[model samples]
Target: MFGEYRTLSAKPGYSYTYTDGWTLSANPVYSYTYTDGWVYHGRSRYSCESVIRIILAETSLRSTVQREDALNNKIRAAKKLADIDSNSSQLRQLKQLEKELEKLKKTRADQVRTLYEWECMLRVGSLRRGYISVKSNPAWYLREELVEDCISRGGCCSRDCGCCERRRLSAKNGKGIGHCTLECMCCIHDQGSEFTAEEKKDFNGRFGKMLRSNNPAFLLRITNAYFSKPLFWKIKTKHK
Candidate 1:
């Protein structure tokens, strides 16, 4: 019996019986075990089924969660676009604000350019007169008799007559003013002095040359700029 039991235990799918003190235990070759002819051990098929089911449940839950997240992302994007479209007034206001900002920027740039031009002109005028000993203020120069009488009263050459408003009104009926009428009028009014005889001759020669040049615009430019003031006097002479 012992030999048969050992042979059965070694077989691939065979059952055996072992007895001890009147107790009999069956050993299953595929699924059961008997230890010391008393204890029986076997495994149930449902033991692995729970673990397999748990893995499948986890995989299914993860797939569902992924699908839900994708759907939510698409919905969020669509809602954002719809909200933008619905706020038409806000969009128009934003565009208007941009235009206003651009206009303000352009206005600021123009102001800066205008200030720069004024600064340039002032600097240029200062440099032109810097080295010259005599400086003429534009306002006083405008009111000067040499400039004003040359434009309004033609000329004056009397040695004792004043060139002020009262003297001019009083002398309007006198004989034609002299050659140095402008100078005499200035001197009589205590405003200027007489030029020397040599200076007078030199002025006549220079003025005659300029007139004979026959460049219409050149004379006009000189007249407008110098305006009866001596040609060489107006030119800024370097003192240093």
Candidate 2:
């Protein structure tokens, strides 16, 4: 006579099985076992913030470019009118438009410089803080997802999304929630080697050129390309 028997055990977190016959065997199974800590979670948060900042900066740049273009068109129209009629009023109007164009160019340069500086500050802060822990609970992830969805859809229109509130808070603090503040002296210490002044200037120059470029589409493309790259935390696996 021959006989065979099998036993199976299952639990919320894990499972196992055993079989007895001509041969015996045991098997173990686990549903989910990976735990992500502060570094992993913080990196994700920072990456998302970076992407959002790039998008916002690009949008602002595009708007400014459009305004500059409109002003140029107006100046051209004024010049053409002056050329055809040669009246004192037309001449004055042409000169005024020229002065306005110069002011607009200066304003655009300042805007670009400000955006570049903000980007530098963000990167510098990240380097200094390393990855600080934050609340990565389900509720937090849900809120983050909601915000991302709203951004993808152009913007959140409903108050329930809390997008406006989040923006207001960020603006008030000049940093994202859960970020380590300058007051946290320990946290302000550089996690990596500090960037040299020359390196910092070079970085600013590169971004300055990109931001000042008249081609809005090219700038948008570059921004999108940057955000499309895989984040470091995504590809890294930790064994525990």
Candidate 3:
């Protein structure tokens, strides 16, 4: 019956609600809840495999974007310096950047090709290998879409929410962009807690039950990525 519903295209920074209601934000980080709500589901094992592949793809994208941005910055600096002062160091740096840009051009092409291949594989492999494609994997795709949609929708919350919160919390705050993390934490925590009596009554009157999940394993796995921060420095020290 759920599958019978027509699939509607949604815009970035906006998710489709059951009715015509617009959710506050599309970012899954900010969105309190979303599940397929459809009866169809992927097997847990296959879902995990699909998620890992998606993660690999995502990591590659993040790494490439960072490198490209860094390269662009270097090129800009080199150009600026070349205009002002054509010193030996500046010339050498400019030449090195030219070489780096060539390398990155090749690298970008390869990555794009690889991603296209992965996209094809994900689409076709689902039937042959029983793995869901990114399009078919609703849960995984939801998170991925949320991030991109958030980034595309002005790359900040100030536009969506009335809070006008910026990336930096305070000048003295050592943890850059920690406010975002804190905001997410509080939002999730509050959602887990008591809502207003009217809200509770309304939800109960509608769904006849409080929303809750019995899956501790799933919770741990989702939050594990956040837990690795403390170990990063130690890991780097050991590697060095």
Candidate 4:
């Protein structure tokens, strides 16, 4: 039955052979087996947990850097604006922004120091003897309370009080009372006449102390301190 048997050698092997209308082929077939060493797919890789931790750390660092850069840019802008014109309407806003930036810088520095302390504590495997810390002095609360009382009794000429009538009158008459130089006494006296002698004495004692300690900037400082009282109290409570 080998009618067309032909021996065709190509590189010491036959490329194709036909015998009795049948075809025979010789080709290698590769196969793979699953083994313990083959589970890694021939690549070095980190564990899933490690990869997740790395990603989180990188994201946190990037966000922190961006926040710091934004704060710095805002500070620079405020400084530039403040320097451009002292009499501009935005002068107050620029000054306030500068003050806020300074506070933020101090806050950031404190946070970094606190973090370093905690890291050190963790490394040493010990706790601090007393972890309590004060964010603000207790004296600030007392001062704020005194200022609020004085303000309510018209010892300080708040905008909400009847003492504003004096300002309106002065403005109408074109006479500046120079309230800063006079310790705001002009407006206070105009409103104080309605209060009892005891009330007036108490107001005078507290207001006088404030004036003597900080003659020019007392009002501004007291106002800011009063407003910040709640924040200080919150921090104190957290520490406690």
Best by TM-score: 3
| Cα lDDT tens digits for candidate 3, 80-185 | 9899999999999899988987887677567656655654554432222323322232222223223333334333332353121322232112111221221232
Give candidate 1's total backbone clashes. Answer: 4
TM-score for each candidate, following the candidate numbering = 0.20, 0.35, 0.39, 0.24
Q: Candidate 3: worst 10 consecutive residues by lDDT?
A: 230-239
Alpha-carbon lDDT, every model: 0.32, 0.37, 0.35, 0.34
Candidate number with the higher lDDT (3 or 4): 3
lDDT for position 14 in model 1: 27
**Alpha-carbon lDDT of model 3:** 0.35
Among the numbered candidates, top lDDT falls to: 2
Colliding residue pairs in candidate 1 = 156-181, 156-182, 157-180, 157-181
What is the number of residue pairs that collide in model 2?
Answer: 0
- Report the alpha-carbon TM-score of model 2 versus the true structure: 0.35
User: What ordering of candidates by lDDT runs from best to worst?
Assistant: 2, 3, 4, 1
lDDT (Cα, 0-100) at 40 in candidate 3:
15
Of 2 and 4, the candidate ahead on lDDT is 2
Worst 10 residues of 4 by lDDT: 125-134
Per-residue CA lDDT of model 2 for 154-226, tens digit only, reads 3332223343333324321222222111111122133233345586467556655654344333333333223
Poorest 10 consecutive residues of model 1 by lDDT?
A: 36-45
| Count of clashing residue pairs in every prediction | 4, 0, 0, 0
